[model samples]
Target: MLPKFPMSRQCPYHPPAGYAALKKEGPLARVRLYDGRTAWAVTGYAETRQLLVDPRLSSDRSRPDFPVLVPRMAAAKLVALVGMDPPEHDVQRRMLIPSFTVKRVNSLRPAIRRIVVERIEALLDGGRREADLVPEFALPVPSTVICELLGVPYGDHEFFEEQTRRMLMATSTADEAAAAGGALNRYFDELIETKLAEPGEGLLDELIVDRLGPGELTRLELASIAMFLLVAGHETTANMIGLSVLTLLEHPEQLARLRADERVAAGAVEELLRFLSVADELQRVAAADIEIGGQVIRAGDAVYLPNAAANRAPEVFPEPDTLDVGRGTRHHLAFGYGIHQCIGQNLARAELEIALYELAVRLPGLRLAEPVEQLGTKPGGSVQGILRLPVVW
Candidate 1:
């Protein structure tokens, strides 16, 4: 029998352990998905980069052929930005490019640094030697930063965060996921109405002011974008911060290097992204019959790109399984490749660099409270992360 796709990682420190055999199968090999559908697993780093840019592959989730890696994505409506294809995708992305530019992200560094500092202080409050980093530190830093950037109130983070967890958690049934998603949509819908009445200086507010009048965007799209940004903005980065901290603790020499020299902080973040690859899956479907790696993916076939595997390809990264903080090569597909690459990558990098570096410096004695094996992974979801990262300084 073919190995199942999305095989779970037995340990949080690496990709799903089964990817080694799968990669050996070929660059584009077939794997069985949950629904018993066979999709082409793009396991080669170079092939993944080539096909991601190919126009024949579609990111559109609306298609019946789109792989439902998890039940939540099955029959779901297309998300505003990530689920689109150009020129609509291009149009939507164009609206936000200026906001995520290097200059703009750089301007937010002071504020991001301040946010990381506050989170560290919170973790250290009451002279507490131990706290769950997931809630106390990792989750809040990016949550606050993204909340401030998107103009969404950080006070309501609990509601939205729970809703997002429900939507993404693998255990959630389709109905439960649908309901959680609906709750978020309704929440954002109301928030949009509120913005209409009392404008705030958020990205959503700017969209409402600038685009709604020109027929350039709709209130619904605004809500979807808000939901997407809020969820994507925090959950992924939060997990990254938690996992990156755990990783650094596991590799003291690398951690010490980062703390000793601030210059390595930026590259360290990149290495962490490549090494951890917390976002384990990036799925696409063939729009037409396409060929790569001596294989043909039929039209309407799903192509699963486990960047987790691709990032670990030995040919791409020497000793692919080993973690190297100084291996800051930007060649990995962690943020993805092609026109659909992550728009918020710069912000994520800034957030990770600030969060990781600050923790290393402030909590020099930081160590994991629980045995690595005793820790729980994020319940089934496309995103790979530790459920609760317990730590003490």
Candidate 2:
């Protein structure tokens, strides 16, 4: 029997144990899927990068034969810009690029810092010794930042957050996930309707005034894109913050280094991104027969590129299991490679760097309330993170 695709990590800090074994087999190893079908898992760093940028691989989720790793993935509405190929993907990404450019992210640094400080303060109120960082700090900080960024009413965070949660839950049935996705789309639909009457200063309003109103993009497309931004703009960052804190706490010496020198923050965050690699495999279907890494992936074959495995490839990162904050890792696939790579990479980088530095410095006395093995995680979705990070100082 072939190794199954979508293996879960035995430790939140590591990729799935099966991934290492798969890598041992070859770069393009055959894997079994949940639906009794077979797919190719690109486990080697070089092959993963090669496939990620190969134009022969299609990201469109609309194809009838598209691979469904989980039930939730069947709901194509959740894959706006990511589920696109060239021309459409290029156009949509260019439109959203202005909002996430380096200059724009630098402008948001102060606001991100303020948000992190406020969350830290909340965790420290009345000299409290402990709080579940996921709810108290990790989740809310990015959720609030993204809410303000997208012009969504912050008061309704719980609604959309829950919907996004259900939508991304791997345990969700196809119908259940569709419902959750529909709720978010409808919410964005109505929100766009509201903005149509009176615009705001956020990204959604900019699209409404420029793209939506002019019919350059349709209501459905705009709403789908908005939902994507709302869910992605925050969820991934929130998870990264949670995982980074846990990683640093486990490595006290590294934690001390991060706290002592603010200069190391950028490099440390990049290494953390490389170390954590919270995202799931980047999925695509072969558009044509393509030969790479001595294997031929035929047209319509499902290809899974697990970045977690690639990030830890011993060939690329010597001592890959060890987390070195000063490695200055610039080539890791924490953000997917090629033209379809993460659009908000700049914003996400800023958020992680600020949050980790602030939390380490503000709570230098921080320690895990429980053993790392005992902590529960919300892993195996489109993203991976702890469900709660109980900590004390």
Candidate 3:
């Protein structure tokens, strides 16, 4: 029997139990997806890296055979950089790359630090013995930063958060996801019009005055890019923040280590990113015939690259399941590989380092308010994260 795609994880920190056996089977194997579609699931680290940069593979979601994780995702149009193919993808990605470059992100470090510190202070000021870290701290830091950077009103965070949640839920119906996407598109449309009228000192305004004003990009495409940044910039990082804290609390020794030395904090972030592998699956399609792992991926064949499994591959990292903060995880596929890798990774690293560092220093007594098993996980989606993390200090 073909194993089902997105096999459920028995533990939040580990890949689905079936993944170990799957990796043992081979580098690649066919799996059945939600809509009764069969696709190739790549589990080997080497193969994942090879295909990630292969020109024969396409990230274009408009392809009929593109591996859609959910019916809702299938119904949605592909207007963002994440779903575009070369030439178009290159052009679009280049336009936004300047804002995410290391130099630019580093320049924002002071602001990000201020946001993290403010959020931590707010949590402390609540005067409560216990608080849900997800909302009080984890979500706010990145959300506020992204809003300021994009010139979007942070007051509308609740609305966009809800819409993004619906759009990404694997079980959401086509209509539900479409409605959520529509809401976000409309919001961006209005925001773009506002920016056009009176420029602000945000990334969106820069794009409008520079790129859009020069007719370098269409209004629709600009809005779509802004929407992508707003969603991707905050959602993944927020989830990572919450999940990272929980993981550290569970591993007290590592937590102590991180607390003891700030120098090792950067390495700890990479290790956690590797171990968690939050975005479990990266979807793609075969644009042309390609031979990999002694198998032919025919044109139009759907492909599912489960990065979580690849990150845990023994060949890449000895004792892959173990979380060692000192482990060299620079080559890990958590942010993915090749040209389509996360553009916001630099900013993500900075945010995580600052957040974790501040959490350690400010709340040295931090502990889970409830049992680890009692914590809820997001039901089904590309991103893997905790529903809520209650903690006490």
In candidate 2, which residue ranges exceed 4 Å CA deviation?
Answer: none
lDDT against the true structure, per candidate, is 0.87, 0.88, 0.88
Q: For residues 98-129, could you state the per-residue lDDT of candidate 3 as single tens digits? A: 99999999999999999999988888885867
How much RMSD separates candidate 1 from the native structure? 1.1
Off by over 4 Å in 1: 379-381
At residue 66, what lDDT does model 2 achieve? 82
Model 3 residue 74 distance off true place after TM-score fit, in angstroms: 1.5
State each model's C-alpha RMSD to the native: 1.1, 1.1, 1.1
| Cα displacement (Å) at residue 371, model 3 | 1.1
> Cα deviation in Å at residue 120, candidate 1?
0.9
Error of 2 at 193 (Å): 1.2
RMSD of 2: 1.1
Model 3 lowest lDDT segment of ten: 373-382
Show the lowest summed lDDT stretch of 10 residues, model 1: 373-382
Candidate 2 collision pairs: none
